[model samples]
Target: MLLPTTLILLASLVQAATLTLKNSRFNITSKDATELRAEPLSVTEKLSSPLKLDRTDILRLTFQVVEKDNGNNVQPHQAFLRFYDETTDEEGIQPVRVSNTGKGKFELNMAKPPTSLPPTGSAPLRVSLLIGSFVHSPLKVELFDLHVPASHPPAQHTEEASYHPLPPLGHTFRPEQKLPPRIISASFTGLALAPWLVPLVLWGKVAPSTPRLFSPHILPFVTTLALFEGLLFWYWIDLRLGQVLLYGGILALPTVFAGKHALASIGERRLGLARK
Candidate 1:
C-alpha cells in the first residue's frame, strides 16, 4: 500500500509541471504588405523600445507552449493577451487561439481595431501574455509596450442631457388659491339657496294636510333619507367615500323595513275604505 501511494504522489508531481513559451516572435506589417519590424520575443526579458502602430498597420504574434522540464508541447486550458492602460486604469483581454500541438497565434489589425483593444491615449499600453492549465502551473509573460494611435471619442446619446440633474424644480403652484371677496361669496351663496324658499312659499300658500307625516313607520324612512343627504354633504366636507358608504349601508336595513311597513299600512287603509 505504501509503495502504491508513493508512486501515485510522484505521478501527480510530474503531471503538475511548469509551462514555458518557445519560438515566440512578433511582426509588424504595413497596409501595402511591407514589413516594418520583425523581432524574436524573449520570455525572460521585455522589449527595450515600445512598438508603434499606425492606423493601417497589422501586428502578429506567434508562440508555442511547452513543458519546462522536457520541452514537450502543451495546449493550456486558457490563453490570453492583455492590453492595459495604466493612466486610465483600463484593460482589455483578448483570447489567443492555440492548436492541439500547442502553437498559439494572435493578430491585431489596426485598420479595423478589435473591441478587445483598450482605448488608447498618449501613453503606451502594457502588453502581456497569460497561460493557465489545470494540470500545469500557470505562466505570465510581459511582452512589450504598445503605442497605438489615440482612439476616436465615444459617441454621445441624443438624449444624454435628460440624464443630468434638472434645475432645482421651480414649482409654480396656483398662487395659494386666494378666496373671493366676502360680498361676492355671500351673493353666490344666497343665489344658490334661493330655490329652498320656493317650497316654503308654496307650503304657506297651499297649507296641504299631511296626516301621516309624523307616523312612526313614515318618520323612520324620512329620517333615513335625510341622513343619506347629510352623509353626502359630510363627504363633500370632510368624510371619505369609504366612511360614507359604511354608514349608509348600516342605515339601509332600517330604512328598508320602515318603508315596507309604511307601504303595507297604506295598502290596508285603502282596502278598508273600499269595503266601507
Candidate 2:
C-alpha cells in the first residue's frame, strides 16, 4: 500500500539529515594532568538523539578559539582532534592547524578507514586541543554551524592490489637473501642492550643525587624511550615514514627531561625543601 512506501521515504530522509551540536566553551585545566604541566583541553559531544550516520559521511566543522587571557596573542595556532572510534580501541586523530584569526573552520573528509564509524555506529565524538604550550587559554568551540551530509562516496575496497617488485627477466632467478645469523644475533643483542644503555648514559652524564638503579627519572625515561623506539621500528619496518613520530620523538626527549624535573619538584615539595 501507499502507507508502506511513505514510511520508507520518511526513514530514508531521517537517515540523511545533517547533525549540529550544541556549542560550548571548554576549560583547560592542570588539575587533571599536573605532572605534564601542560594544558590539554577537550570538548566531547554526546548526541541527544543518536543519528544514523554512514561511515563515508563528511563532517564540516566551524569553530573558534575565544582566548580568555588579555594581550597574550600568538599569531599561529595548531590543534588536533581525537575522534572516538567505535570500531577500534585506539582513537583516531587529525590535525587542525590555522592562523590565529580567533575563528576557524575546516572539513574532515572521512575517507580514512580509521575515521569511519563502526558497523554498530558511533554515539559520541570528541574534538580536543592538543597544542602543548597554549598558555592555558579557554577554547570556545562552536559546533552550532556543523554541516554533515549522509551521502558520501562509498569507501574504496581495502584488499591490496598486487604488483611485481622486480622487472621481468628472461629465465633468470635471484634467490631471496636472508639475514645472516651473526647480524640477526647482533640485532637481538642490541635490542636488549640499547634500552639499558640510554639510562646508563643519562646516569653518567646527568649524575643525579639518587643512585642510577633507584632513580625515578631512569625508569620513566627508559620506558618512554623504549616506546618511542618501538613505534619508530614498527613504522620503518612496514615501509612507512612517520613524520609525526619523528617530530614526537624530538619533542618527547625534552618532555622526559621535564619529567625528571617534575619528579624532583614533587619530592622537594613533599620534603618541604623550598628555598628561603
Q: Which portions of model 1 miss their true places by more than 4 Å?
A: 1-7, 31-40, 44-48, 86-92, 99-103, 112-123, 153-180, 209-276
Error of 1 at 143 (Å): 1.5
Please write out the lDDT profile of model 2 over residues 54-145, one tens digit for every residue: 34544444444433333233333455555543433434466665456534444554454334332222234433444322334333231221
Candidate that scores best on TM-score: 1
Which ranges of candidate 2 are over 4 A from the true structure?
A: 1-47, 50-52, 69-77, 111-131, 137-276
Give the TM-score (vs. native) of candidate 2: 0.28
**Per-model TM-score versus the true fold:** 0.62, 0.28
Instruction: Give the candidate number with the greatest lDDT.
Output: 1
Poorest stretch of ten by lDDT in candidate 1: 151-160
For residue 258, model 2's alpha carbon misses the true position, in angstroms, by: 89
- Looking at model 2, the pairs that clash are none
Every candidate's CA RMSD? 6.1, 38.7
Provide the global lDDT of candidate 2 against the true structure: 0.47
